[model samples]
Target: MSSNRLKILHWSDYACPFCVIGDKRLNEVLEECNIKDRVDFEMKAYQLDKDAPKKPHLKMEEVFAKKFGISIEGARDRVDRIAGIGRNEGLDIKFATVQFTNTFDAHRLTKYIASQGKDVEKFIDLTFKAYFSDNLNIADRNLLIDIAEKAGIDKKDASKILKGKEFSDEVRKDEEEASDKGIRSIPHYIVNGKYVISSSEKSEMKFVLEQVLKDEAEGKLNINE
Candidate 1:
């Protein structure tokens, strides 16, 4: 059966804790509205730290401190605050253990997984867990393959993609599109290609979706005007 549904495009990065929370909150709203299948959701790649080293250049706490010009103890407190927020969302984030590295490969892997028609949302969720909870290095090809396999992607195909440049263009395309959209931060969401929500607030996400869904049903939503 053919139907009209709101299409939601999401841009996020694996290293972004806020993106994780934002995605989770969006899912919560979708479930609450009983519209999970009514919304066409696509996850796009966004690298929070494109210039980050392939290996951990410094501890995540130290990186935070240096970037924000704060003390190491202050960085730890900031991380703990985010982790506490994640815990409220049922995610246990081990920010202290996270190996801060470039997430380009991780984004490429997600593109490849989507190409295979697998559960990209599940794959993305697992990728966030792999980094924030398990503290796995998302830049590692072997780790990506293992994570993909766990997400039900074929091991052989995952291995091939990880070993080569497959889906690299798709990753770049997502990043370029994000740039064009003026997305300066992670967890940016565009609903029905019109409505833009740039926060991780569950209530705000719920309100946006509810309004969009109503407007969509009434034939009143138009983005091309």
Candidate 2:
């Protein structure tokens, strides 16, 4: 088998619960196989509820109910289900405390973090936990800088990037690219530049990765998405 790694471009939004769940599942599979070195994962940006109002720091349940026209109880149930999935993957998802905020700046910061070749996975996990579990407003620059520093980013540089809208264009480009590819949902995984798995269906994700590795082993350069 060739030692080539498969590249997976994952488009997701930190504000979305399902995207976080999908990310956890993908990470689990990669870790279980000891294939961290064999997989190149890039996280793109996608907004789930782009039109949500930015004020009063609505809870996840409130946001869900308002956006989907469902009752608060129904939204809570949905959050519970998603939270259950997250808990299984070692995430402490606090549905009630989740504050849905504009993630544009957060996405920009992520792009900047990737540019630094830092541990983006840890950065992303911390950002999700901060916003969804710790009730931190991700759109706030100070909060973003703190999270970035926690992810090993330089405090001064993180503050500069967050304060000045650095990497915002790159983030917008990523969103445009996702739209160009007809991606309308979060947790979209584009594997090997061909096989596109929408949402993190764990079994499907594993199968796709396995196939990519198999093809690489056979000296075949097939793009699946």
lDDT of each: 0.85, 0.80
**Best model number under lDDT:** 1
lDDT of 2 by residue, 129-161 (tens): 887788777877788888888889998998888
- Clashing residue pairs in all predictions, respectively, total 0, 5
| Shift of residue 179 alpha carbon in model 2, Å | 1.1
Predicted candidate 1 versus true structure: per-residue lDDT over 119-147, tens digit per residue: 88788888888899888888888888888
Q: How far is 11's C-alpha from truth in model 2 (Å)?
A: 0.4
Off by over 4 Å in 1: 1-3, 222-225
Task: List RMSD in Å for every model shown.
Answer: 2.3, 2.3
Q: What's the TM for model 1?
A: 0.92
